[model samples]
Target chain A: MTDFKVKGKVWLITDNNGELINDIDTDQIFHNQFLHITEISEMGEHTFGNLEGWENFPEKCNPGDIVFAGSNFGAGSSRQQAVDCFEALGIKAIVAESYGAIYKRNAINSGFPILIFQQINNFVKDDAIKNLDEIEIDFLAGELKNISSGKIFKINPFSKVQKDIMEKGSLLTI
Target chain B: MPGKTVIEKIFTNHSKEDISPGKIVWIDLDVVTARDFGGPNVVKNFHKNYEGQSVFDQSKVFFTFDLTVPPKTIQYANNQMICRKFAKEKGVKVFDIDKGIGTHTLIENGLVPSGSIVVGTDSHMNILGAVNSFGQGMGDVDIAFGFRYGRTWFEVPETVKVKIKGNSSYDYSAKDLVIKALSILRTDKILGKAVEFYGDPIEKLDLPERITFLSMITEMGGIVGFIPFNNNTENEIKKMSGLDNIVPEIKADGDASYSEIIDLDISDIESMVSAPPYPHNGMKVSDLEKVNVDFGFVGSCTNGRIEDILKVWTILKGKKIKEGVQLSIVPATIEVYKQAFEKGILKDLLDAGAIIANPGCGGCAQGHIGMTGKGEVMVSTGNRNFPGKQGDGFNYLTSPEVVAFSVLNGFISDREF
Candidate 1:
């Protein structure tokens, strides 16, 4: 992909079998117990806290790190805290095969970047994508390049409204 | 114009400009609602962002205290207090802690008629689709904006048409249909898309059954699941609110364009349960034969209506559940509670050894009764069976009949057992 803009280290959300965990719901991202905490900064510490085998996501995630996940990544609950948790972590973007309806809307409205990487499974099997691998993304083209491995994968591009909403910075401004 | 789906019609009605799926458009809202769970956060955002500005319309705004009514924790108490204060200042209405679920309250109160657009804080607000209305759940930030402007931006979503075919047997209920559908369709088929259900069997579904079935679209990763308006819908509205002007404004064209189409038959559908860890993990009740149940809950937005309660009573009448199984019966709304009390349904359930709780979202939020202890297993009528949804224990979702039967047997069972 030419004119690569956003770049970051890859962080994969996989199960113990190293297979991508699909249907990673909002409850897994942010548990209901922490709903009382209103401060955005505090939400990061609890990111992925409810998820099995990923309780340490908050402690391990670094700024400018991009996350990859399986389909329906943000399933369940419209709790904005799910999206805010990633924003608090300073994550560059999340690429999943699909997303929950309201969760996708929340991320787009908050100006948090999210993309759909349809064939992430095949790439993971080929060893072309790995955790901590450097990568660059072309948002408009929906192209993701493995900078370290010299491989690229096709991704669904943002819709017109999604781009406008992200560029305008939140739904209210749009 | 080529034919248009019901969603297209609804979106076009809310928006003045020409609209299409995937197109960004600002739409007017018919109503804005928030529950205790998210109302406080909306108030906080309103003060932080739209301070000194009047809400777009006070009459259309409502605060429903159903998520954690009576304030089990100090945090929830303070949150409810904030919502009450903000609602009073804005001259809006607060349904209070005794109102049960906010969405069900709106339905019971006739606030949401067909074709109406409703925005709320509860993610399952799309449950409104059962009545042919367009309902969606958003976060506090979105609700705060909606409160200020009485409008919000939406990407018109394409529709998936699911045709429900065949008749159900005596033992099977709408909950069985929903779990069965979730198993076949899973999350991939409907994610971020609207679903239109039309077929022979669907027309026979009453409002309560429709609510039981439609409430699950969220679990299946769908934006909304709609059943076209029928005589039962009108009859329920009249019976519930004494209003007859509830006919929706639009219907899908005969030749509407659809992203995908599916047909699901229920003739062979049987009692099933969505086992622990996921809502869509459906397996036959026979498959869970020997699994002992420590607790049983027979209510929620999914199956807490009077009709469902009637089903529970029919199954448990004159028969006590297992001596050790702790059974809790929580109705969906205050109106439902009143109906049950007036009709002696609650008395029968209580006589059957059920500990009746106040009308609200029980255990679904871990807010009220039905939350399980570690190693405890609960068979619930609620839609979700998430890991920590009802408690530390495993929550298996099933029909009211099945839950009632399980409580009687002290283990998961079908009606015949």
Candidate 2:
């Protein structure tokens, strides 16, 4: 029931929190061109959210958008519900510098495309509002290209099998 | 030639042919466990994907609803409902709610045999390695594949032989020793390796203490951890499981191959504590200076055993917890609670100002019960002090003895006793 095609602009999320989520920081360090750095409110059940005046994220993100963040973005308790909620809200790919071990495994098994990039925070900042047209991800090249800005970021691409699963939407379909 | 170790010997004996690291060979599974938290997902995925009429083997599948049961329990009941439905539909063997023993205890009691390779969806599934079984936590996809095909692939891990020699004083428990060991050897050192605990000091500890030691091995990121089965272990297994005359393989051959061997003389190991942000960042209690504490938690699979409770009781006897320090004690299982009650340890803990919680992984999971407030400092007996792990606070990982002493002293204490 989930869509597999990667479309739309990439917005990178940075790890402004300054710690590893699951010992990996793929979101913050790896896919910065497609990253969006937003101030997350530590409110309710969610760990990170928009700072003041930016709570409407569901409207901000569209289909085929990519998200990047700091280390341990999805760290803490093993609740797949968070992933389910994110998927429902239209997140396509998640690239981070690191992730919680269990969270990384859970996200992959659930059919999300996660790329681990080392040293992501150094390239991107939380204040930048990335335009969607500037980003392109080449799975084979292990890179995320910024077409508008002409910036290319290196990445560790998914394995062939993992790519196949992502293309098919989720492992559930495969 | 590589040196032989206990893990290598066991793997070779069980392997169908000569094997090496990264080789994927099909072997018999000794045990498979499913908990309510993620078991239903595995079953659902298996039924949807697997083209089969029946399970691979009924005996190998062990089910229990530990964390989330119902209103009487700590967390929600939805996960348990799904698990119960799946068990009924498949006619799977399961342990009931009140009768449900902890997965680690149940496996050790008899559901899992010795010299077996076990996998579960729960991350802490490595707890089963206490009885010399090779156990690891897998994702739901892996479980579905395992259920459908009755086999799962694994890269044979290089083995690490940890030889412990000499005896420790009665006050020093395995909990203290493991914290000390992890402090010396960070989680990265044992990554993708199997750590086999052996030697004279291992024999000196009782089954509960041994289980406590093996329970936290996953904190070091080891693939699997274990201790060889012996007569003493067999007797304890029989006593709990009511199985008679069951003897398992004891010691591996002297020439067993191993990737590395590390020897330790821990007879003089004092109590240790792993401070916040990392489990391997440990320090001797004697070296730590006193710091203000807001919370003290004494429970979790790591330290909720009866012996741990007795130790806490010894420290809390005839004294109340320091004012403003909130202490919560969660028994690992109902059986453990009953044992504590039988020995009057429960009353002592309650009288000493500790709130008693039901048997399950509470505060440890940070879902409900004893979540740390922002900027609060807590001393706990749980494993893993990673950021936001025990709530938005600084969590210090230590033994039950240290937790008790901290509760009494109102700060991090360096006292030997």
Listed per model, the TM-scores of chain A against the true chain A are: 0.95, 0.65
Top TM-score: which candidate number? 1
What tens-digit string does per-residue lDDT give for candidate 2 at B162-182?
887766664777788788777
How many Å off is the CA of B53 in candidate 2? 4.8
lDDT of 1 at B27: 94
Tens-place lDDT digits, model 2, residues A62-165: 76677766454543333444354456556677777755554565666667777767666665642222535546666656787666677777888776555656
Q: How close is each model in CA RMSD to the real structure?
A: 2.2, 6.4
Off by over 4 Å in 1: A1-4, B167-170
Q: Give the TM-score of candidate 1.
A: 0.96
Question: What TM-score would every model get versus the actual structure?
Answer: 0.96, 0.77
Compute the DockQ of candidate 1: 0.62
* Residue B280 of model 2, lDDT score: 77
